[model samples]
Target chain A: MATRDELLACLAQFRDRCNADAQLRPMLADWERTILIRASDLPAEHLLIVRGGQVYLEPAAADGADLTVIAESGLLADLFAGRITPTEPYLNGSLRVLGTEEDIMRLDFISLMIWGE
Target chain B: MRYVVSVSLGSSKRDHEVTAAFLGEDFCIKRQGTDGDLARAEELIRELDGKVDAIGLGGIDVYLYAGGERYALRDGLRLLACAKLTPVVDGSGLKNTLERQAVRYLEEEEKLIGPGTKVLLVSAVDRFGMAEALAAAGCDLVCGDLMFAAGIPYPIRGLEELTRMAKKLLPEMTKMPFHMLYPTGKKQEEKAVTAAKFAQFFDEAAVIAGDFHFIRRYSPPRLDGKIILTNTVTAADVEELRAQGVKWLVTTTPELGGRSFGTNVLEAVMVTLLGKRWDEITAQDYTALLARLQLKPRIERLN
Candidate 1:
């Protein structure tokens, strides 16, 4: 069983991985919008994406935000770990897009870049 | 035609009798072993050899596997699997490990269905536990039901709340999870609303409730797509839904002890109607589906 802190650290690592990849440069432009991950029995929160030039952490939700990416923590871990396929959660309802479909699709591509299949 | 199988580790005739009464004549009640023993369990499963529609393993430790194989018990009956008989360990790492292992077994051994299948995982505790396990196991569209205290006591409200209260009352006390709880009269109504809400999120949704009244309250939205109902839904309810053009209908309550036991009949019904085997689905699939449906778990754990 992974602790909540451990799970949060894993998400941070995933964000770092996305920053190190150069091919993902194009999608980094729209990373400012908030990305909220809701999982387990916890509440939803903004995921902070720290960026320095092209190197960036994907934009997550702040105290208040326009976009939220809700999913079970385990699902997020699996998505980041490559145990399951990307876009699988959104399509299946495990990963829900509470924003507009377009915003959701944009984030979907970003997620693909971060997680890479 | 509903098929049922009761998987047990011991000759707990009471357990067999109870399961048989709930599942009816088409069901198989096989004895396995007690405690952490699987030798007899394996023998019983071998005898099943495709004769059963679904297998219900009595309360046994799912984590105590002798070799490479793990045991899979009925969905939502985690109390029996851990045999803790108290709520203190409900959210403990041990239970989580067992849930993950059970889900893994289901994924590796259970069969699959077409694109139309709907899977629901009902948890009396944190909805995320089952959701996370299922997702890790590769199930895509699993949904979950959270049990709540609908102002009732005993079997209706589920024992989770009392456990939480006990934890507060006895800060340093160790706790065991109990399965018995009070029933929520509004469970069916509340679940129906939940189903309708979930219909918007997933292509399919499975709403698990204790009684037929819940199914009756499940009036489909004006949306274009079709939704399936299961479990305690009777022949009359099926006729009603069919009249309304519900394309799929299946019953699974008999498999979960029976409709009388208030197990997740809707889940079984959805599995059968969608032609999905238990192993092919995971809690993540159901959680994701519910998330998409915007279907909140009925129960809320107090911090």
Candidate 2:
């Protein structure tokens, strides 16, 4: 039962951390696209737009997103918090990803910034 | 701190902790064992009754369901009598509720199974709730109760056909203990999976749904993109699946501490979190709690 505001803050932090990390910046530089993240249970969606080796978070949709991730907010938080594995929800069919294979690989790498494992 | 203990007739091999978080609450199920002695299982329940929040009776069932008819087990009644203060559940209470939610989530939400998607359910008699949900969702289903469970080699058409078959066989099946019906012995250890043998069903079906052990026994070398819908898997099991090129695996049961969990522990957790006795919680309550938790299966890509 994470509040909407807390989940939003976590998303912002992930975006900010991704922008700051040197290892992740190089990976983000390869893709200049918007990514839409929507929660299944809550009416909250965040768009991450990557441009010029930096990632930015926006509240609304943008043109030509790279990936669209649909999952519950709790699951998203748990993934970032390293409480649950990224592949667990995806494998269980709770997390849905509409992206190329390369994008999926890069997304997993970006998650490494938040969690080492 | 809420304490939930699972009293099991299984040996130390089956006894372990299950840690998980659901609906913002972190919970744990302490596995207590009796080394396969049924009397020890009752003794443990009697010992922990008032001290613990709830108790989960493992390796046995309260009832064997056959459509509308339910045959209650004498062992289950004796165990229930042993408990004085806390609610003790054999996990049958949540079968209809949790299992139905598990199937519907895969169809309506996850979109894994559609109108024409062929599904192979290994045994409808064992997982009746899941079978009912699959049929209600309108998937072309192959019920393998007669084939897999009874060694009859007859794949029933729909849930109705399987229900009729179960009505005939489940009474006899219930005469023996549930552990005899679903063994945790050497049969569960070694999986004699040959892709060539089940190629016909694997070729036609989009998903193969069944009990975990049943699926494990018949799993092929490669799954391609076929989704496995079952319960009770371990971390080692996932690695085995990944090595076999299983692109997606969906467990009906929620995973905890790097493995899928038993229904007994799951039902006990629900009873504790709901702050209600097992008898007080209804199927509707389970469905509502399932919605609140938004429990769905996980998938992996190895191919």
Candidate 3:
């Protein structure tokens, strides 16, 4: 399990990385959605609002989200912070992403852009 | 006659059945497409498991390789696991050995590719051997893995960059539904809107290579004087290529009837002829058999 502060810090790092990537913004130009991140091992939830090709973290409930990602808090932290690739946990059933396949693929591409490998 | 069936997730419109003999051994080879239905494909694999001498899983890859690293596709493995008695392959083995040999043959004998020849490989992770061969032969290579699969505009310029990109993305990408990565079923039949967008890559290259679908996906409307290096084209597909002004059509696999089959189906044929379990076979075995069969690239000048 990861503490709320720990997850927040990791997400903040992710936001900084995304902001630093000028190339990634154009890729997300038309993709605007609210993504809900819920921790499976804890009663914690966060919101990621994407508007105008920028991602913002909202420390709130999972309301009216277009996409939802459910995973352990530690896994979420690792994934958002670029410490681990999303493929292993996704395939092993530890990570569950519920949304349109196009959205999911876009999110994957975003991660790839932020982290080279 | 030995029976070999290719259970594909592609459109049934591409289904084919042929009777052929290899080195005095008669075989009945058939392809049954499931139109991108995973469960139906699994069921068909289960039904044909023990009944068929060998099975080939098409429109999906059990594994994708890049720079010595191999990633297994989740859905592909699921379909592969349905067969308990018969050996199943997705043609990665043939792509590695036979396609590499074909690239060499074209370069050495046909004088088609050589140093400074501009080549655009539609997707390389699925055909790493050909990518490597082209790179080694000094063709100015651009790999379209990113452009074709992810809708990304970035063109990977060299093998090093391609390998780097593959290492970063393939782990997760391969885990996703195989359809999202490659076109299947009706998706295969539709012309991609992005094809015209990426036509510059096609117009600049002297040779276009890789899976026929991927090449066709990002191909421009007119490919005047360009050589297409791929396999698994129907007669209609050939005409379409001719209409596009493709100068040369080179299929890595030999022509069976009027068309050449996908590597998966051809690999299943080889498995039946060798009478070997899938795991027991090696790349050398495939290469040796390719030599014995005297299978050469089906190269035709279309325009």
Candidate 4:
């Protein structure tokens, strides 16, 4: 199992690498929504958001978050590594969604990000 | 007996669909209301009564919707109506209900097999809770998992090797034949080749081919008085096997999510049907004894 800190580091690396792309830069710049990532071992207040030119990570709930993704940390790695799919995990009970389809579909970039190879 | 049971419940979001698979025929069994009403589901179940040996409930939501406030009573009656009622559980309140009822049924019903009977378990994936239940039931268990060589990838030739290894390893015990279970939407030919290899390893083997090609192409050189062939046997299959002087078929009910066999129900049903008296016989006698009694049809429902 990857630790919370390791996961955060991986996410940060992904953000840094992807942000360098000219096309990706515009998307990140305008990515102004709050996203709550609920993991089993982590505190519920661990929030990630992008506001203006800065990325924020703090122990506070982001108000009016656009999406909440619920899954175990290991599953997140598998999803990010292209070992499985969002639908597969959800059908197999490894992933659960409490939000609308739009909220879930917002993360469609995940497939491209992890499995572009 | 051919059963056409329908599982009906209240929740629309819940997965109440029934997955029925027999030899050469597998289909989704569901009750769609004309106006999406719950009564139609109930009527379907009533229509299927006394026709099928089992009516499998696919998920927890279906149970709640079907039983309503009186879900417990309805659930019990549902179990009694069919020879078997398999309720799928996936970390919900419904699982708790099924667990409670299953324990009671085991206590009241006769054990499926006699004490110390040896049984074999084979699967291509993880065998969760099955080995434990067999142990608890006092079965002398011999189990094996499929192994793939490095770089071989999924659906490898390991199933055949695994069967051979099992036969070699379990020389003293009677092998309960082999069954191949594949995921939905995957082709059965790959699995058939594996099953054929398994049958080749032993004289008397049963191959469960989910696809048509598998059912047709799988033919091992006749070991004559040694091997008996079955292609995805149903209730009718069991009757045919019994008529052919073959007895003691080892099978299990499908578990939730359609991955593995249901340990709780299989254990309870096995104990209730087989009894615990055969546990005392020697390995040789046990094998001979099993070859005499016709066993029940192994049923598995899709998630």
The C-alpha TM-scores of every prediction are 0.27, 0.63, 0.87, 0.26
lDDT of 3 by residue, A2-63 (tens): 99889888888888888778877765666788988889888788888888879898886636
Which candidate should be chosen as best, given DockQ against the real structure? 3
What DockQ does each candidate score versus the true complex, computed on alpha carbons? 0.01, 0.01, 0.37, 0.03
Q: Ten residues in a row with the worst lDDT in model 4 chain B?
A: B172-181
Ranking by TM-score: 3, 2, 1, 4
Which regions in candidate 3 have their CA more than 4 angstroms from the true location? A1-8, A21-78, A83-99, A113-117
- The digit string of per-residue lDDT tens for model 1 on B187-222 reads 333334334543433334432321234234434542
- Superposed model 1: Cα runs more than 4 Å off: A1-12, A17-117, B1-78, B81-188, B191-229, B234-244, B252-303
Give the Å error, residue A9, model 1: 9.6
Best by TM-score: 3
The ten-residue window of minimal lDDT in model 2 chain A covers A108-117
Error of 3 at B236 (Å): 0.6
- Give the TM-score comparing model 3 with the true structure, all chains together: 0.87
Report the interface RMSD that candidate 4 achieves against the true structure, in angstroms: 19.6
Ranking of predictions according to lDDT: 3, 2, 1, 4
Report the C-alpha lDDT of model 3 over B1-303, residue by residue, as the tens digit.
999898888899999988889998888889999999999999999999889899988888899888899989989989988988999999998889999999999999999999999999998988999999999999999998877887766788998877777787887788788888888898888888767767889999999999888887668789999999999898989999999999999999888778889999889989887788888889999989998999999999999
Write the number of the candidate with greater lDDT, choosing between 3 and 4: 3
Tell me, what's the RMSD of every candidate?
A: 18.6, 23.3, 3.3, 17.8
Which is the winner by TM-score between candidate 1 and candidate 2? 2
Candidate 4 local lDDT, A1-117, one digit each (tens): 667776565455544545444433333443465666677655533455656534465544647567666778767656544555565566566777555443343343333433332
Pairs with backbone N, CA or C atoms under 3 Å apart (clashes), candidate 2: A90-B299, A91-B298, A91-B299, A91-B300, A92-B297, A92-B298, A92-B299, A93-B297, A93-B298
